[model samples]
Target: MRLTILALDDVFDTGLTVLLDTFSTANELAAAQGNPVAPFDVRVVGLGRQVRTALGFAAPVEPVDAVRKADWVVVPALNAKLPHLLLKALERTDVIEAVGYLRAWHAAGIGVAGACIGTFLLAEAGLLNGLEATTTWALAPLFRQRYPDVRLDDTRMIAACGQVVTAGAAMGHLDLALWLMRQKSPELAAFVARFMLIDKRPSQARYIVPDYLAHADPLIERFERWARSHLADGFSLQEAAKALSVTPRTLQRRAEAVLGKSPLAFFQDLRIERVQHLISLGEDLERIAGQVGYADSATLRNLLKRRLGRGVRELRAELQ
Candidate 1:
């Protein structure tokens, strides 16, 4: 694979190094094993010979022109606070040029892969439209708003839309690299995994706090605040709509458009999240179940199972 890594100012250093080191290890392992396992020609390229990172360090790389001859192009995650990072990234002349470069390279049949906030770059270029992709879970609201045409599923750690792949938050780079390596040689991918002590992680939902993305929009924000207050007891969609001075349909629309959950289900998710938090503090399951309006631990267990695909024991461990 002729892999070219696109480095930009304020790049997520950890994600960048993960790809570089992993692929370097892959090449070394392939050479040691020989024959069937082919080496990955990983080239790190920046706007210039060097690009500044958010961590106060500078990364030196080949010029961007190197991507012209590459078979795969990689975009590393952004390192700064997301609000600032997105604004700054979209404003850069370098990003503008890179978007064009990506459109051209991908049209020429080169695979494009992005990790975390780096997926936003692909979204900005309109390359991910109508494709299933994942970005940092916390940034899903922004991604959805910016690229509504793209199918955004942040629950999965990696989403492959043909030759373009988008990965979830920060450490997702490891998963993305492993997936790419596996595509090349599953045997070599296994060998590399053992060497790196990395395991496959397929979901980001457990780590996501429910209703967290709701604050991105005013309508969603208002609903979230009201819902959180009423989670101690159950509330109806009509009551919530009346309280918010909107019709039930309006609340439904806002809930679906902003958070992608029905109002009743969203309310239940908030309750579940509250239970998880209590468990993280070592609260008793029976006690939490009652507080959240569930009759007993059995009912709570069913709720967790229905929404999160796990029981209280596993969900507690995940949140903690």
Candidate 2:
């Protein structure tokens, strides 16, 4: 397959390298296995003839202007991990050009994929609008605020809407590469993954820090503080709104806008976080359940399973 790996200036060092390594490894493995699948025709294309990575190393790259055709265009994350920095980076002339090129490529039926903040580039191109996508979980609130038309599912490790693919966070670069390889040949993807000791991470939920996400909005921050303080008590929308000095409607609206969840759902998230913390302390299921305002251990256990897709025992084992 012809793959164009688009390299933005000051791109995330690991994100770019991991894609190179993964695809190169897949080619080696395929050759060794003597399979019918041919090696990938990969080119790391830049806005210019060369690109500088976040780590200050200059990478040689083919100019995007010289590209004739490609089957897929892969975008690796840039170095701007914070919202403010990313917003600024997106406005740079080079990035603007990259976005334009991405739009043209996709218009020509080339598959597109991005990971971490690179997903923002795709969204900036209006490619992810009205489609389900995933990005780094911590920046999900900012992503939602920027691209309200996009259905942002921050919980997923990889979200694919047709040929447009997005993956989560720093290590999600590997996941994105594997996903593209899987599209070409599932068996090849599996073989490359096993040789690299890469395991499937289906959801980004476990890695999320709810408080960090809440910090995006002042009201949500206050609401999160209230929720944490009242974990042992039953959630009351009226009471929470009263405590935050906002009406229930405003509280619900802000929560949904910034966190993409209702107040009660975020409360459940806080409760689940508390349950995990208490579990790490070796607390019994009954005690943990009571601490998180659950009526019984079974209720908490089921909630944990439903939300995180892991049982208490499994979570505890992971903590160990």
Candidate 3:
């Protein structure tokens, strides 16, 4: 496979290095295995003659036009204190040119992927419209505001819809690369993950701070406060609406508009988060269930499984 890894000014150092290293390692392993086919051929392309990393280092790169030869164009995440800030900064001529390259490649039927904030650039170029994609969790609000037409899921580590693939968080670059490797050779991808000590990250929801996400809007913030207060007692959307001095319909509308979910769904999300926290503190399953106001441990167990794709044991093992 031939990959064109797009390097941008102030690109994330770790995302770029890890992506290159993954393909390089796969190539080495393929050669060692005496596979008849090569694993990958990678080319680094930049808008300008030179590119700088977020770590204050520079590297030379091929021109934007070089992407035409690639089977896949990989856009690594940007390095920014706040990824939303990076999105605003991306209106520069160099970044816009790179977005155009991505748009052109997509129009020509080539596969395109963006990890973390790189997904924003893809959205900026209008490639993600009508496609399911994922981006960094912290920037989900801004992503939704900017690209309301795109089906954006900030929770999933990887979301591949047709030729447009996206991955969440900063290190999701690895997840995206491994997924591509699996498409080529599932067995080899497993081996590469084991050798590199890369465990599966099913969803980015575990890394989300519910408080921060709620603070984006006043109604959501009020709901967050009500949910937290009622976690031990139980949730009542009707009562919550009364407390917030709004009609139930108004509350439901705001929750749906701001969070893209019903009040009940948001309530369950908070319940699951509390369960995760209690488990992290070494609380036993039964005790956690009682504390989180669940009548039985099985209900909480199933909720964890359904939401995170991991059972209690797997989640606890990760923490330990």
Candidate 4:
């Protein structure tokens, strides 16, 4: 397979390197297996001769114009982790040019993939419009605000739709690379995963910090506080709106606008967050259930399993 890695300036060092290393490993593994599978022909191409990484080192790359013959293109995340910094980086001239290149590439029917903040670039290029995509969970609110047309589901570790693929967070780079390898050879993808000690992580829900997401909106922040204090009480949207001095409709609208979820859904998120914390503290499951406003441990357990994709035992083991 012919693959091009888009190396933008200030790109995440690990994100770029992980792709290089994973594909390189796959080639080595495939060769060792004495299989007739064709190895990936990978190229790191940038708009300029060299691009500085986030950690202040230079990587030499081929000119972007040379990538026309590639079958697939992958974009690694930029170093911008915060919302403001990411927004600023998106406006840079080089990134804008790269977005144009991405649009042209996708238009020509080349498969496209992006990891972490790089997904933002794909969305910026209008490739992710009307497609299912995921990004770094922490900045999901900003992503929703910026690209309302795209179906952004930040809870997923990786989301693939049509020929476009997107992965979550920084280390999701590895997942994206493995997914690409799987498309070529699932056996080789499994071998690479075993070699790298990569575990199956289907969701980012467990890692999300609810308060950080809440702080993205003033009303959400206040509502988060109220929710935490009233965890024992049943969720009531009207009550929450009254507490925040806003109408129920306004509260619901703002929550959907900022968090891409209903107020009731976010309330469940807050409950789950507290449940995880209490589980780590060795709290009994039944008590924990009541604390989170669930009437029974079975109900809470099912909800936890549904939302977090893990059982209580697994969650506690992970916390340990």
Candidate 1, residue 119: how far the Cα is off, in Å? 0.8
Q: Mind giving the per-residue lDDT tens digits that candidate 3 earns over 1-320?
A: 88989998889999999899999999889889998778898889997788999999998899877878788999998876474577567877878887888898999988999998889889998998998888988778778877889988788899998889999988999999999888888998999999899998978987877777788778889888988888877778789899899999999988766666778888888888888778889998998888777889999888888887889989888877
Model 2 off-target regions past 4 Å? none
Better of 1 and 2 by TM-score: 2
lDDT of 1 by residue, 1-320 (tens): 78999988888889899998999998888787765654788888987888888786888999878887887899998775456568777878988888888888888888999999899889888899889999888878777777889888888899997889999999999999999988888988899999999977888876777666776788878888998888767778898999999999999987776665678877887887888889889999999987887778898888889777888778667767
Writing each residue's lDDT as its tens digit, candidate 4 over 1-320 gives 89999998899999999999999999988888896765799999999899999999999999987789988899999999999999999999999999999999999999889999999999999999998999999999999999999999998999999889999998999989988998888988999999989998888887888899999989999999999899999899999999999999999999998888999999999899899999999999999998989889999989988998789999899887
Instruction: For candidate 3, report its TM-score.
Output: 0.91
- The number of clashing residue pairs in each candidate reads 0, 0, 0, 0
Model 3: colliding residue pairs: none
Error of 2 at 30 (Å): 0.6
TM-score of each: 0.91, 0.97, 0.91, 0.97
Error of 3 at 116 (Å): 0.9
Whole-model Cα lDDT of every candidate shown, in order: 0.85, 0.91, 0.86, 0.92
